[model samples]
Target: MTTIALSQEQQLALSNLCTNIQLWAKELGFQQIGISDADLSSETERLQQWLGKGYHGSMQWLEDRKKMRLNPELLHPGTRRIISVRMDYLPEGSQQIAILKSPEKAYVSRYALGRDYHKLMRKRLALIAEKIKQDAQAFIPELEISSRPFVDSAPVLERPIAEKAGLGWIGKHTLIINQHAGSWFFLGEIYTSLPLPVTEVITENKCGDCEACLKVCPTAAFPRPYELDARRCISYLTIENKGEIPEEFRTVMGNRVFGCDDCQAICPWNKYAKPTCEADFQPRHGLENSDLLTLFMWDEQTFLKNTEGSAIRRIGYELWQRNLAVGLGNAPANPDIVSALTSRLPQASELVAKHIQWALVQQKNPNRKRVRKLSRTRV
Candidate 1:
């Protein structure tokens, strides 16, 4: 990576600009902001090994853009620093485990309970980028602060970058966990050419002997501490797989219709997790407390209406119905659930029909058990 030769006076100006940037970020509703030099060399091998093992499942894009993830300069030319920001997204009154334990209710991941975060975070990051461009012109009139903002839309190693930026250490679940903020937040990044001083990596790997996150995964997604085998991860199976929910994991999937949160919910540090102040992050359409059968009954038009601005809309109506069918199957056998599953089968695509058939069999068996391993310890 080429280093920009900035004058000593310009360096001082960059440092001062960072201070104002943080204040501006907080005003824009981001909980925290940290800056890191654009060097992800430390994570290159680990990322390669994870992808080599095919742990990313069918997410081939991770491997497709291998070089870009390791080199920030490749993402935005002349990039020298990355500004990583986090926003708490855990909705207030989140009955995460309660909904999971209820068998009959759908347990959408807390992050997806509200409107999609991409637009919100991207808009905020773009504001900061514009602010930097305007502010830097005062110091160096010719300064070209080439910049780009990313929110899960890129192949960037968000957790590693956030950890380097002093935001948090990556917990056992591979999610960034701040000592003070837990893991219930969203991450956004601004790749730029500014020579900003890197934020000190103060947060240590406090996950130390505690493996509660690993133990709580119903499908045993963690092959080892600090490593996630996405193939077995419920989040990947339900959201990213875009195919069949393996039979082995379907029974253990419980009532999680969209994405799973067992790892985050069971983390002891999450006790420190705060509810989000952003109304946009709050649950909408009664999604936080909805029943599996109720959600499964939604026709395509209703599904589109309810998930209008929500993150759940990306999976399309087919996968949404597919996941809900699995949740209904894990739900206790009820004539209502049975009827819902039966009603959707004839109209369901072959992919969804298979899950509906699998669900019908579960509904027919009165002896079926949910066998959920995780319990609600936080509430």
Candidate 2:
């Protein structure tokens, strides 16, 4: 460790600065903020092993930027510390659970129900970075401070960084979890050149003896704790992976038309999750409880307009329709649903048509159960 002599006055000032950062973080809608050093060799090896098992499916990019993901300095030269922050995204009450069990309503992941988090999180991080700069200039003028905000946009090992920063430990489901905040939060980071004090009290893994997330997988995505088979994950199937929907996992998908939250929902730790106070995070376009066929009927223009600022927009209208077709197919069949699928059949692309035809067949035989159990628990 490089020892930089600090007078008692400066030491006290730095302590107060940390306190101020936490308070400002809360004021800016962040649930928590923690600082960590920039070493992630172990995490890099784990990632390589996971990728080696071909768990990433069509997401080959995960294998591309190894160095940047493992070291913040690779992404931003001179980066010496990472400032991680969390923001809770779960909507109030049991809306997500209720929808998941319904089998008729479309279960969009709670995180995607609001405005796109990337922009919102980056905006807040910018403000926080500005605050830190202003304070540091006044108190620690010798520090060559440089900070940049990031939210799921680069090759940052966010979960590992969060763990080192004392935000939480990586759960079996591969999501970061805090004892106080649970796993219902979005993580962002600020890569800073300043050698900030690291949060020492790292969260100890509490997934002991319990594999609720592994057993709850609708597609058996978890090969083991802290390891995920992305090919079997609903979020990957519905959002990231393009092309045909695999037949084996379709029936278990139920009415989840977008991202899935089965693993997070089943984690017992989430009971302590706090609902977000930010109005920007609340559900929009009635997506929290919309029916499968309802969302399925959105025209291309309407889909674009409604999802203008939402993360769902990144999937494009074609995939949106494709996913909705699958959800409608899995829903309890009815004349209305059949008619809707039939009408769209002529207009859909080959990919959408394939899913639409599948939906029509499902409508023809509503009670036809094909592989009813996706997994023992994780759905």
Candidate 3:
């Protein structure tokens, strides 16, 4: 292989090369691309505070590798610049409000309905990294340093890096949201030795006075505008937290079987959000607007087969059933829904059985309409 010791002229050429790379990235489905230095001290402090509050719940991995998450060089030896890219992932016509309003229907967050984003984003980032490698090879017969691509796999503080790279500012909901593209995007990072010039300006916070995301949370998961209590979060209860979901959150959970999107769905800026061009992100198995009992009836084999490449598969079949059971409990009482609950109760795990029993009680009381209100206490 050829090695290039970049001189003044070569450095200038590399800068121009980076601009071309951004253009190419845009062509290949990235909405925006930015470069930034790997300083994440501010984000590290915020993480520490959030963890100190016990908001991370059982996700002890956040406590591990304190330094590595804040420093890119700790993860990748020669990392100098981080190339951050955003690809919008919102699927079109995912009637969120209608599903949330309908107590009988389940509401899986749009992102999880399709294929898992980790593999898809990593593939694209790898392709981008490969292009950089080829460009370097042509310029300097031997560019010894290599580029490594990352999706949410490592200690990489993706949002802060993206913020510095001018992708978007972290909203009160703690999601990075572009002014034009909104918050419906997947982020990817490429750690490289190549010293790309950092983006001149970071995005200014556009979340001024708008606590819409904070107020719209079904579980009141936010401690304040910027902080989140993950234990109380429905997304955490339904997906990340392995054991039984706390009793308090079940009723308010409504029909959200997988992840909750109440915050994003209510965000006024999301009107600007663009639909994804990637067919991989399109909803599968009619999950975007499925009935609670319909999804609750899927056996383990059917669950595994249907959610083969989906992000929802990570929660496993039991938790899937557990979450759907909660959704079923919150659904308005019906004989069909009751029969479905009764059928699953015998086969369910203790965690799922508890929720099924709750559903049965709800089923027996045919007159009560389950109101959509979150539990005040953290699960």
Candidate 4:
């Protein structure tokens, strides 16, 4: 642990500052906050093993930053403690399962149903860091404070840090699950030089024998408990992998056009999840319940306009069309859907054209039940 000599008065004031940080976090709309020493030696091997197995798929950045990800001090010089904060982003009326069940309707991950969370959370993290810096100036003038904020960016291993900070336990599905908040939240971190006391309350794993999350995955992305094979993950196939999605997984992809949330939706722990009041996270462009055909008909201009401030925008129009074509293939056969697929085929990029061809075949073959990766009938 990194330590700095502190006067008795400075130690007392620093302890009080920790309490004040949590209060400031709440005011800035964070649901919870915790602190942890920047040591992740135990996770190094697990991360290495996952990468060695090629589970990260085409995300080469994860490999390039392997060294920095394992060492917190190297990622951010002078870092001594990590401040982890959680923000609930599950919006009310998302109707996740309802949309998933309706093959004709698109099922966007609840997280992307609204504005991208990266900017909002990053700004809040910076505010907290600033507040700490100002407080430190008053309490310990002799010692300078240095801090950096991150929200799903850089090489930081946020989940492990969050776990150590007592924000939650990493569940079998490889997501942080809090007994009170469940798993429907975003994580942000601030690497600070402060030697504030680390969080004392470590959450215990409560996932137990429940395998609902694993069994519900449309693509069987989880190889085992606490392990993910990103190549087969619907979220990865739809958002990260720029090439054609593997043919085998397309049938079961269902209507999850942008990202998948089947695992989280089926987890028992999420019964405790709360809705966010933040307007930025509420459903925009009527995306929470739009039809597959409607989204497929959008021109590139319309697609860009509707997704202006959304996380879905990152995937771009071509990927959006490709994913929607897959969803159309899984939908109950319809002539209008067939016509839309045919009309777009001529204009689609080669990557999207192949998916359109596949959708046409599925639409024409109304008699056969599509093969699914999982036994669940919803697929």
Highest-scoring model, TM-score: 4
Over the stretch 129-182, how does candidate 1's per-residue lDDT look in tens digits?
A: 999988998887765667899999997989999998999998888999998989
- Please write out the lDDT profile of model 3 over residues 1-379, one tens digit for every residue: 1234578877877888888888889878888899998777777678888889899899888888668888778888878889999988888887888988998998898888799999988888898898888886676555565799999888888888999999989999999988888898989999997767788984899999998898778888987888889998999999899998888778888888888889998898899999999999999998887888778878889999999999998989988988888888887768898888898777789988988998889778868665566543443
Off by over 4 Å in 4: 1-3, 375-379
- Candidate 2, residue 164: how far the Cα is off, in Å: 0.7
The candidate maximizing lDDT is 4
- Residue pairs with colliding backbones in model 3 are 2-141, 2-142, 2-143, 3-142
Order the candidate numbers by TM-score, best to worst. 4, 1, 2, 3
- Stretches > 4 Å off in candidate 2: 1-9, 375-379
Superposed by TM-score, candidate 2 places the C-alpha of residue 105 at a distance from the truth, in angstroms, of 1.0
Candidate number that wins on TM-score, 1 or 3: 1
For each candidate in turn, the TM-score is 0.96, 0.95, 0.95, 0.97
Query: Which residue pairs clash in candidate 2?
Result: 215-377, 216-377, 216-378, 217-377, 217-378, 218-378, 218-379
Cα displacement (angstroms), candidate 3, residue 236, comes to: 0.6
TM-score of decoy 2: 0.95
Runs of candidate 1 with Cα error greater than 4 angstroms are 1-5, 373-379
Best-to-worst lDDT order: 4, 1, 2, 3
